[model samples]
Target: MLLRRRRFPILQHLGVFSNPRSFLLHPLHSPQYSSSKRNREQLLNSMRDLKTVDAALDFFNKMVAMNPFPSVKDFNCLCSIVVKMKHYTTAISLIKRMHSLGVKIDSWTLNIVVNCLCRLKRTVFGLSILGLMFKIGLEPTVVTINTIVNGLCVEGNVEQALGLAERIENMGYESDSYTHGAIINGLCKVGDTSVAIGYLRKVEKRGCKLNVVAYSAIMDGLCKDGLVPEALGLWSEMTGKGIQPTLVTYNCLIKGLCDFGRWQDAAILLGMMMKKGIMPDVQTFSAIVDNFCKEGMITRAESVIGFMVRMGVEPNDFTYNAMINAHCLQNQMKEAMDVLDMMVRKGCLPCTVTYTSLIHGWCKIKNMNKAMSLLCEMINKGLSPNICTWNALIGGLCKVWKPLAAKELIFTMQKHGQLPNLRTYAIILDGLFKCNFYSEAISLFRALEQMNLDRHILIYSIVLDGMCSFGKLNDARELFSCLPAKGLKINVYTYTIMIKGLCKEGLLDDAEDLLMNMEENGCPPNACTYNVLVQGLLRIYDILRSAKYLQLMKGKGFSADATTTELLISSFSGIKGENAFQEFLQKLVGV
Candidate 1:
């Protein structure tokens, strides 16, 4: 049998008895050069040229059935092509098939497997494949190391990734720009830009020229951490070193500028980017539009949308949401709804943010009917209301004097797997207090207290104000006194509320003492506090004390409120002509 195999090579046994030169030169000439090898080559070429997943799969199935299987290189090539088509799971299966066919998996093949696993977010499995490479004695190249680091970073194991990068470099594997880039990127993602910049300098010291991706990573981290000036300085430094900023660099800077309300600088940067032939993407436009919306610059936001469309960049859901939110901020619900309609007509579905902004707008105007209608529409569309959406709806109901309905909605939300957060509770308590449902608010507060939910200063203030509103001055005083012991710093609002409550009870001395104490504690009262006090004094007809507060308010640049102004006018109008009241009016005018 051995002598026969030597006499006729393996190809001849497979009925490929053709001249080798004819097979190599005119491989498709069937009468002269048809062979299994040519058939496999044609199949490999077909696999490479495949544009769709189904075609790649069909060719892959055919390639696996050959008697003398294809070379490992050919198999790896097919697997790579499949992976590039984003058929990652299929690529993994193909790798397994190669292993099953007793085809050896070299480092390159295993690297492809690692990449596919990482793409699937199975970085742990990718690590196992790296271990397999070690077990098979296949030396890992820089690509393998970088792939592992990237996988670790994607899985948010930045610390482990850094350690691996260090180990590989210490093992004399000579970390490349890609390896250090992965580590730097991981550091930046975890908000360790300070350390990431250190590593960046280390990479430069390693004799590897840092690339745009590495620089962009650090800039992005700095920007996200609200260090826009530092990020911009770094940009200047990068450009000074002849490193031209890419689209990513410009986008990061633009976002950073917008975050800090540096709109003028952002526009300048946008102009510079366009001048450099780098087009702004949806993210860039979205950031600008969102910032404008937040600033209540709806017209400017619309102009940006027009510019985006003119630039051939179609607005996405986020773009529409920004516009919707802008109109909502200005209480322009009709225009907001019109934008929503336009977005839907363009096949862009309104997301949670879109609905939330609209609901909040209607709630702002106490239009619970419209809010509820929109809420129902959202649910009918199978979009579940999130905590923010619930908060807006509940707050709206409360604003419309429907605390009972708002409470019911809260329970309904919990039943539907949306837990009420502290903000939700705060909204409900304020609503109940304002609507005179004190008993219900107290019950809810006790329930939350029993559950050990954190009571922030705002919640405490709300409860205190509620007690004072209902003539429970003792309870309000008790809570107010316990604020410091509860580890809550008495903010200006808190002090102001306590002062207002005391004044309401006609405890002017106590109110005056608290005001003095707040000033002593450096929690100086604001204009609202002074206004409240001035109004309170005027209500009691303490003209001299009221004038003292009014003068103080004026000295501090606060105008007397409408009620105070009306009372002053009435009090002066009733006085005899050219009397003491006329002199007081002249004094007040000079003030």
Candidate 2:
């Protein structure tokens, strides 16, 4: 068998008696050649027209059962088509059938098996196949190694991939651009942009060409990390190297700039892309529109939409959502509704976010009917409300002083497999306190405390504010002290609320102490904190102490609030005959 194989190496490689050279040679040289050519062409055309796995399998069965058998190339062509169809296991099965038929395997044929294995995320089996290649005396090609490297990268095994590349190099198989690109992209995806950049430098030193795909991958990673300046610098370097930036490259930079609120810079870059004949796509325009709407630059957002339309780039759902969200945020429901109508007329269907934004807006304006109408519309259109949607409606119900209705909403949420998050609880508690339902708020808080749910500080803050607002001073103080033991970090809001509570009960000294303790505890008082303390002291007619804190507040650049000013004006009204006192009161009010 060895002598015969050695004597007819091409025949062994082909696994058939038909010489591959016959197809390459002139058809006129043999009468049989043109007919063989016709069969080969017809087979290839049949493979090209294969649309389903069953059709491909039928083709494979026919090819393997041919009298002399088709060439290994034809079998490989069939295997590749199956692989493209994502029938990895079926491709492997077909290749296994080839081996069983004693069809001598070539390297390309083996590579297909390895490719299918890797596609299945079984890179370990692919490696075993690689071992089989060496055992069978077949030299694995660059394409084979590149496929494995990409497979490892996809599986987030970057280190192992690098090691494999080194191993291949030692075997006299140098890594190509595809190999380097895969590793660089892998590093970036794993958030090792700095490491990926280092690898890029190594590629430069080794004279391995790094293409725009690799550059774009690293640039995208940098932009996502908010390293926009570094990304832009790299962009300059890539452009300076005469590697023209692709649309993806521009989109990454544009999105990053917009994310960081560099709107003007983003606009300039968009313009630069246009001048360079790289037209901004829908994504590029959408990013600008979304960010502009978020920053409340409605006119600029509108202008971008106009330009996008003029350039014949139709606005997608996100583009319309940005417009709707902007108007919704500003409580301009009529204008938002108008945008919604325009979206519908233009054949751009409104999505869940569109209705959610409108619902949240109407809720903000306390227009529950409008909000509920949109919710019904959203459901009628077969769109399921996400958690944010439920949260918005629950908050809206609570905002309109309807705590019972909000609880009913929560039940409906549960029916839809949605659970109330901590934010939802906080909203309900705040609403209860606002509506003077203190006992009910207490009952809910007590019930939640016994549950295993990880409690959030916001909920505690609402409860604390409730206790303070409704005159539960001693109980609020006890809970405030226990919060530290409960592992809750008392933020400035909690401290300010406590200070106000203490001052409300004529505990001016303790409120002052909390104000001092707040600074000592590293939760420094904001303007609201200072104002709360001052207003509390002024409420108890402690002019001397209040005036001293006013001086301190002024030194810290904290201005008196309107409530504090009103108190100061009222306290000094009877003594207006004294010009010095009047001037001091005016100065305090201004401060």
Candidate 3:
């Protein structure tokens, strides 16, 4: 009965809250151990220097065999070191063995178990273990509870994390920097930057020195929300408080500045980060290059690529993709292909995005042969064609006046399990319209509506524009009237299209009414809207109303586009005020 009572009794205690960890290895039957204090010191130092999970396990097994077994602190220290290696599972395995051997476990040991469970994304089980700690006579500490809080934040259950933090604080426990950082980061991650900034201020007022993690996180949130200036303000405040910015801090601020086309500021920040010895990594340069590409500053992107080479920072896949995509967008296929070759030569494997961009570039120039060849090459290289890849080719086929070919590509992609998204349908609808398959386009759109797919406003615009340009004014008007019934908010573009259709049919009065109605209903006319209306009037030789709209365009600080200006100049034969057009041109060009 005594022997039965002592058979690994801690198993029952751990089993209630432990994971089903398959760590059932038995300790050696006659393991030897030295009583020499020097031997134990060697074990401790060796454990500290351990690098791999396998070696760490061997040390744990050896430690359990020591004559005067290492203290719980020694075992706890081994677990801590293993945790640093990010081998949470191995740490759990070690803990399981310790319990089976009846090594008196402490709160520190339970804290590790909680951390491992949480790191593995099992916060519920971690929370349960916290409860188990008390039942097994081990008091939970602030660190143990904070691990759960951080886990909750990581899993995006931020509201509950904040509530738990407050509950713990109210229970007379002083939360540390980790606790405060977790809550602040959670707020930022959930895109509640307003609440995050407020919480930051609240924490500062209470004398909690916000660390670099908290500042970087909130700065990231602010930057993502397009509040770059506000994030810069926080940056100044962070530096003013003598909190040294980390690589993450610099990366966030630099990326934010670059995104807003603030190149000079980004350059200055890059210099500052270098001066601080916090060298920007591959990600930082990639982001800067990406932003430069996005803003159509390909020359700047090329220059940055050169600078990256000079700084011994080899551009990664993102860097290559950005440059490739920028050249592709500008239809500079040679430059784009050159970058791809360089990427391959440098052993930087091109991803699906890489081929997709090249395919799109070739498509833009109506070179379906080159685009199709590249698609085959991409497949032969073991890269599967994504939806964007097919869309690029489909759009290319459409550009070549082959709507039927585009539709066939759509069916081919479906066979490959690459389902068509809304964008796919949008491209097809646009192609059909461009290729003069008006009835076919209408049928496809009707099918989409019948299927209850979320047909977006852009899709409707394509259909409306196609109807108007096809001289189906009555069909266009009926469809325009049905937009409001369909719960689509008529945007400025849609309103402009209707105005254009009305003017194309010589319905000058109705066109003028819709243009005036745009602002009354809170949708103001942009430069394009006014220009479209003017061009419509000029098409029918309505010089007087054209003059009125040109004056309105000037008043709204909108200039006439080249087409509108060309039409106005061409129609000046019926009017005596040719100087007025010249004068408007001068002011429009800031002369």
- TM-scores for all candidates: the values are 0.88, 0.83, 0.88
Q: Which 10-residue span in candidate 1 carries the lowest summed lDDT? A: 10-19
Q: For every candidate structure, what is the RMSD over all alpha carbons to the true structure, in angstroms?
A: 7.8, 7.1, 3.8
Candidate 2 off by > 4 Å: 1-36, 45-62, 82-105, 113-138, 155-172, 198-207, 240-242, 341-350, 369-384, 565-575, 581-591
Q: Please report, as a residue range, the 10-residue window in candidate 3 with the lowest summed lDDT.
A: 1-10
Provide the clashing-pair count of each candidate structure. 0, 0, 0
Tens-digit per-residue lDDT, 1-591, candidate 1: 222122212112212212133322222222222347766666667665788867765565565556666678988888788888887766766665455446666778878877977887777766776665665567888888889899899788999888887877787887777877788888898889999999888777767887788899999999999999899888998898899999989988898888788888999999999998999999899889988988888888889989999999999998898888888888888999999999999999888889999999999998988888998999898899999999999999898899989989988898768999999999999999999998999998898878876458988889988988898999989888887887888898888888888889898888888888988998888888887887777777777887788778778887766766777766676655747756775577442
**All candidates in order of lDDT, best leading:** 3, 2, 1
Please, what are the lDDT tens digits per residue for candidate 3 over residues 1-591?
Answer: 322234334434444444343433544565656768887787688777888877777787688779878998999999998888887766776777776676777789889988987998878777777766756666789899889999999999889888888887886878888888998898898999889889888988899887899999999999999999999999899999899899999888888888888878998999989997888888789889998998889998889889888989999999999999999999999999999999999999999999999999999999999999999998898889998899889889999999888888888898778998888888889999989998999999999899876457888888889999899989988988888788888899989888888888889889989988998989999999999888888888776777788778888889888898777666655555677765654565333
Q: Any runs in candidate 1 off by more than 4 Å, and if so which?
A: 1-34, 205-207, 541-591
User: Would you list the C-alpha lDDT of every candidate in the order shown?
Assistant: 0.81, 0.83, 0.84
Q: Clashes in model 2: which pairs?
A: none
> Model 3 compared with the native: what TM-score?
0.88
Which residue pairs show collisions in model 1? Answer: none
Please give the TM-score that candidate 1 achieves against the real structure.
Answer: 0.88
**The best candidate in terms of lDDT:** 3
lDDT of 2 by residue, 371-412 (tens): 899889888998988888888888888887898788778888
Clashing pairs in 3: none
